[model samples]
Target: MLRTSECNSEQNVNADGYRLITNENKPPDIKYSKENSWVAGVQMFVSFLLAGFGMVAASLLLDLVQHWDVFKQVSEVYILVPALLGLKGNLEMTLASRLSTNAHLGHLETSLGTLIIGNLCLIQCQAILVGFLAAMAAVAMGWIPYGEFDIHHALLLCASSVLTASFASLVLGLIMIGVIVISRKLYINPDNIATPIAASLGDLTTLALLSWIASLLYSSIGTSVILPSIIIIVGASLVPVCGYIAWKNKFTKQALDEGWVPVVSAMVISSAGGLILDYTVSKYKGVAVFQLVINGIGGNMVAVHASRLSTSLHTGQKENSVLGKTTKLLLLMVIPGQLIFLYTIGYLRAGHTSLTPVFILVYMSAALLQVFLLLSISHYMVLWMWKLGMDPDNSAIPYLTALGDLLGTAFLGAAFIVLDVIGDKDSDLGD
Candidate 1:
């Protein structure tokens, strides 16, 4: 029996020159033993770089906030924004985690039958259920305007979330499968590429879908009681029906059993962050872009940690043993990424007229604090879930990303406040 520790080492040369098997069930042909940790880390970082671009693109959604009357009038849209963005990222990350695990285990079959369809069902089901829940939760949290938490608000949230999630999942699911296949062909580990790629695509596609669909639904028939009512009833009804199917279907059972708790918890947490973001968006110009970029990069870092740890756990590595390596690697990778985010955002948003040293210091300080907190949280969370016999893949990304959003928003807001206070002090000194 090959021990898991040896799997991490360079491939061994046995007496007959046969490679050691990573899994007893799968042959050596399927396992990526030679890829090593550094290779995997580099691949993940590259994928993350690409994911960064997708995240940056999500800033376009903020343009709607600046320009569209509908988005401007509906405070609920801000509530919907974080939840929807987080939802898309959460679902895709989860899906990619699942697929990566499948690829790692050599269980990824030649035909995309059971694996693909079951996961799709799971993604769509969660999208529908979570979408409705997110809207309701937003209302409960009072993220809506004074008079806007009515039937129309509920209908718009439910309809947009459900419809957009369903559409996005289907499209994103196909894209992930293609990515996995290509990675295998290219001798790259799918585990390294799939999650970030899927996550990036999820952010870009879902934001576009949610914005267009919500606006389309609201504008054409918003005033009519019948349209929103139909959306509410039908969408609400599908949740349980989908739940029942997920319970019965073998393909989707793992997702149903394991996927919900974390994703829903994340959505609720993200909605809290959304509340903060919505309140502060107008007060701080260019913060919307900051929120999207920080959350995206922060969340992707968590996913990387989670995916790497999940693969480790699945391959029989001890949780504690892998934790240090993951942490060190995460620190190395996340620092440069965060630096890139801070410089790009600071320069693009603040540099046109004048870039102050105080502003730069505050931005770096706040952003670093967020990243430090996130990395520490992710390390412990993955280990804790593993110790508890829960799957980290199912729990980690959702919780971490949501919390990342919450903390990222808070940190960014606090930075702005610091900048304001210091600016005031400087003015007084001059006088």
Candidate 2:
């Protein structure tokens, strides 16, 4: 959109000719470009606020939705949930990451509009493909475990997933384009801000869409399969059409070829995390309330780290280790940032006060550990991906954020187990 206006509009067009105001004529603001500890801290803190709130809302909605007849009748959606949600990291956040990297490398200056449109289309195409595959995986997981496969349920998951993903990607892609363009214009680092914002918003919107669509489809299942069948077929039909268009675009062409492994792999990884979520929530219901917050925060932060390092690699900045300035600062940020949300979680949710000093200690350790390990992984992962001639923006985030989800979810479950063990010990001693 900006391409038609800002990219071409002449500053002085009142006379016989127009004057182009080039980047050479307009210098970037000194304040916005220079990121010190304070600026980075402020950005990270503000982002964490939005991230925490959005995830809490998504988690609450999920808790409510799971009780509905749709989810209860067909449990396969549980298997699909994390896999689809992971695409927020895989498709949408990766788009943000790619846009941020392009912005930093001055590609935006040359063709911001084309970059935005191409990347947005690419993400939508990816969302369709991955969403379809994730649905299949969910259907298989739901069937193989029970030895009772329902083609009706299978079709529902596929339709719900493809439609939700396509809709969510279109919505989130627009938001990403707006966020990246505005961040660049404001001299803020899109890398620092874009991925988390996309991710946080993606979780909320995608969850809402998925629940609503699934419920609608579930209600109609007894009467007709026509609706669901049309959805899957049409969605399948678009794959090649969108794929061809994305392949034609220079900004997204190479990405079409090399990034499938990470997306599909990340989906499988997140499914395991989702399985853990199911088990943990069954034993400790409180786990669902905060799992989204803790696990989401971990993934959001690491996704940011991944996005930044990817931008760095694209800019020709050699990153030899994970112990650099940003790495250390981000690592230190995990404790304070996570504690604020943990406190908020305690304050807002009822009867869920696992905020005992002992529990807090365990949770904080998990938060810090999740972030630290993910940062280290992203650091080297991005570098290695870049060296092997694959685009890190496309490949690295899916894996890192998926791993972040797995680690964060597992550690949270572990924290609950630890709290239980200590409580049992205290009771024995008291008795």
| Winning candidate number (lDDT) | 2
lDDT of 1 by residue, 1-431 (tens): 11234223233434533232254444354347555778878988899888887876776456444446556755677777888778755787877776776676665653257667666767777887788788787666653355434666666767777777677877987888788877876778776788778767878788888788777776854567676567667866766776776566554575688777888888988888888887777666556666777777777777777777777666655345433765677667766876665566445552111235676567667766776688778778776776665666666788888888888888877876676666621221101
lDDT of each: 0.69, 0.77
Query: Which ranges of candidate 1 are over 4 A from the true structure?
Result: 1-24, 29-31, 143-149, 319-323, 339-355, 424-431
What does candidate 2 score on TM? 0.89
User: Candidate 2: which stretches are off by over 4 Å?
Assistant: 1-34, 350-353, 424-431
- Distance from true location, Cα of 402 in model 1, Å: 1.2
Q: Estimate each model's TM-score.
A: 0.85, 0.89
- The per-residue C-alpha lDDT of model 1 at residue 230 equals 76
